[model samples]
Target: MKIVNFVGYSGSGKTTLIEKLIPIFCAQGLRVAAIKNAHHNFDMDKPGKDSYRYRRAGASQVIVRNADRWAMFSETPQGAPHLSELIAHLDPADLIVVEGFKSEDSDALRLEVFREIGRGEPPICQSDESICAVVSDKAREAFSALPVLDISSPEKVAAWITEKLQIKGIEKC
Candidate 1:
């Protein structure tokens, strides 16, 4: 499967852009999967719930399932797992969109999302060669060397991704 990463500072619209792109890709008959890296402690299970209780009871892994969906929660007290290891657990898909994990190196294509009003930090592309494009609300003077896309238009972004990956049968919307 092909992979792409969307990296940006907090509130830079990375997750919002991904949410918009998922349906567009799916509408084009492509199977899309996503992996989001939570930098802080997160809980999918609630206290007093069986899954949560199991985890509290020292279960290394707890799976909660219903008719509609299922989720497996695993503890990683040692450390976070590698990107490759996380990818291995997902079912096969046409593309995988990874959010965060900015420091991990891989062959996955990278798109740096930026909002002029969000943060003042330098762009990730300035220091990282893996970034192939920048999607932003306004043109960034520093990123003139790379392709810049309008943040309001997810279709254009999706089209560019398809073209870059040479994905077939997806006509530009």
Candidate 2:
């Protein structure tokens, strides 16, 4: 599967851009998967739930299932796993859009979502050579030949990605 990672600072519109792009890809019938790297501790299950109880009882991994969908929770005592390790658990897909994990090493195309929030912080792309492009609210003149794309237009962004990755949908969604 083709993979792309979107990285940026807080409030840089990374999530918002991804939210817009998913539907465009879906309309073309491509199977898309997303992975988000959370910086804080999070819980998907609540107390008193069977799956939560089972996990509390020390099950290394717990899977809660129903006809519509299923979710698996693994206890990561060793801390968070790498991107590739997490990807291994995913079902097959034509494309995977990863959110965050900016500094992690991967073969996936890294696109930095940049918005001048006036924080006075520079873009990560300046130092991260892995970043292939920049999607920004600003124009191409803002970047120094790093392939700046219009952030307001997700359709163009999606088209650029499909072209770069050579991705095509075989079926209609």
Candidate 3:
């Protein structure tokens, strides 16, 4: 499966872009899967619930499924597994848009878009060579060797991703 990561500051519109692009990819008859990384503590199963109680007691992983939704809960007692290990659970898709995992070195094609003026350039991906493009709103000059994309059109961004991954987009007639 082809993996593309979108890296940027908090308000740099990563999620928004992904939201717009997902439908576009689906329209092209390509299966799309996305993974987002959150920094703070997150709780999928709410407190005071059966699953929550089980997890709180001492369960490493808990999965509860219903007619409508299927969810899994996992706590890393040892440590977090690497990206590829986690991604293995996902079904095969044409593309996987990863929101974070910037620190993890997976064979994902990285697209590091930045704000360029205020926040300055993002730290170079030192430990990983997965960065295939450095997209920016204005810092294109500094990263002269990388491909730059406008922050406006999700189509352009999606097109770039599809092109890079050798995935074809259905033409809109």
By TM-score, is 1 or 2 better?
1
Off by over 4 Å in 2: 140-142, 171-173
In model 1, which runs have C-alpha deviations exceeding 4 angstroms? 169-173
lDDT of each prediction vs. the true structure? 0.91, 0.91, 0.78
**Residues 7-105 of candidate 3: C-alpha lDDT, one tens digit per residue:** 766776778878988998988888889999887777888889999999999998899999997889889878777888878989898889899877777
**In what order do the candidates fall by lDDT, top score first?**
2, 1, 3
Count of clashing residue pairs in every prediction: 0, 0, 0
**Can you write out model 1's per-residue Cα lDDT over 26-109, one digit (the tens) per residue?**
888888999999998899888899999999999999888999999999999999999999999999999999999999998898
User: Which residue runs of candidate 3 sit more than 4 Å off their true CA positions?
Assistant: 120-129, 169-173
Give each model a TM-score. Answer: 0.95, 0.94, 0.87
Q: For model 1, give the 10-residue run with minimal summed lDDT.
A: 164-173
On TM-score, the leading prediction is 1
lDDT of 1 at 89: 100
